[model samples]
Target: MAEKIPAGGTDHPGRGDWPVIPDEREADLIGLDLLDHADGPDLVLFLAGNQFMAVPELLEAFRAAHPKVRRIFCETLPPRLELRQILSGGAWFRGRLVTVVPDCWATVSEAGVAALAEAGRTERGQCRAYLRNRVVCLVRAGNPKGVAEVADLARADVVVSQPSPVHEDIAEHILAMYRAAGGEALAARIMEEKREAGTTLLTTVHHRETPERLLAGTADAGPVWATEAAHAAALGLPLEAVEFGEGLDQRGRVRYFLCPVRGGAHPENGRAFMDFVRSPEGRAIYAKYGFLPV
Candidate 1:
């Protein structure tokens, strides 16, 4: 079983503080102890799900800048629901004050930001966008099926793997774009023809997993992040990414944010972290990973 760390303990040097440093041997017990130090009103950033791939370096950078930050807990949830929780002040994680920062695709209009300010809520503007990714058809080493576009997904023998629309918002957005681009009818036709239509294609693979699966011959085609695909190509994944002419809109890219909860314990610390995130140094790190500075 996985080791469980309890919440709320006295502050001391520990392993959890270094999220970027991978543990090669045993689980870092010191790090877990540090998490217990975070208590009441302390800043707890709840990242909108789907941005996990780029978190390691960002966390490392933040920790380097702000050592006083007692604990940094990264949690993930659906974007829409996370937004509602922030707006409604719902209880999350043992009633500790929480701030919601949606992934990149979630865009808050200027009006929404202004409204948040008028309501006397602190706007940290910590969330930053880094990379843009698109769904692609990943095939084995060679073009066996001759798959080219979204329309080709209708081929009787073609096996396509996709993530569930309910959990994978990106997949849903991709499907929406595909339909808007006139591929809807074709998609329906494919489903009707293939009685063994597989929703299992919608497995919980991450952006990196798609490429890995394709290279391993586990999947013929799967959705993958463009940056991950680029990195995978560099690593020689025997895969090719077939881009659909009409792709998901710019809104599909994931964004990261740093927000201060209304009643947070460490408002000052949260603000400091947010400011650092936007500073030249922070922007440099984000840019390194293909993130755009806000």
Candidate 2:
């Protein structure tokens, strides 16, 4: 079983705070936490990893379109972890005394959505693609290692911060892209040889740690979703996105899909939130944060 998120831990942000009212500061709220129904949020979301930057904007737009949904709570976890939590009906978040189920769930991998459907976790015919993205390399500002593309990741001189394939789907995408560029030899070298030599570092929370590693000068570069790199740049962080050429960076579009959870307490509001996410306004909000509209 996957490790449970320790409830009420201050080590990571968004532990105890949840069911927040949408406000101008929404975009700045990027922490994962548990929610309590005692306050009664109108809608709750269990979102896939790496959407920390776009969700707040999406929530704000959702509120504007549906004023009735005044409170929204969300938990952003790795898709597999989120799926496991959904299957189990609730998760034991750090510091949280009880488990809480969400009304809606979104994942970057369609496979995750399919898993939920196969498990009868979502309402039938309710899932849809909402946003698109691609992969890229995130390097420290000025790109100290002079890394430019996926191929350079294979270089002996370029130390890399890599995500764990076991934990994040994006990690598999990265390995595949590397294979496409230089075959399995490249993938093996990075995943095995370089990893053993400490030239390739693995991250526990891929998306969050990429920028942290870069800023801390612990890694020369790391593969990440384009939006993640963009979010870091938008925040004026000392990081730069290095785009890969065609057939190299997993340029074949990745996607974000959402569905209302079946048997959830707030089915009506759940469907409404899904509709708002697919609306033009929702797409615009995603686009503003570097997501390509589906």
Q: Which numbered prediction scores highest in lDDT against the true structure?
A: 2
Model 1 lDDT per residue over 201-267, tens place: 5444233345555656655676554444555566676767676654443345433334455655456
lDDT of predicted model 2: 0.72
Give, for candidate 1, the lowest lDDT window spanning 10 residues.
20-29
TM-scores, all models, native as reference = 0.60, 0.83
Model 2 RMSD in angstroms = 6.2
Candidate 2 lDDT score at position 39: 60
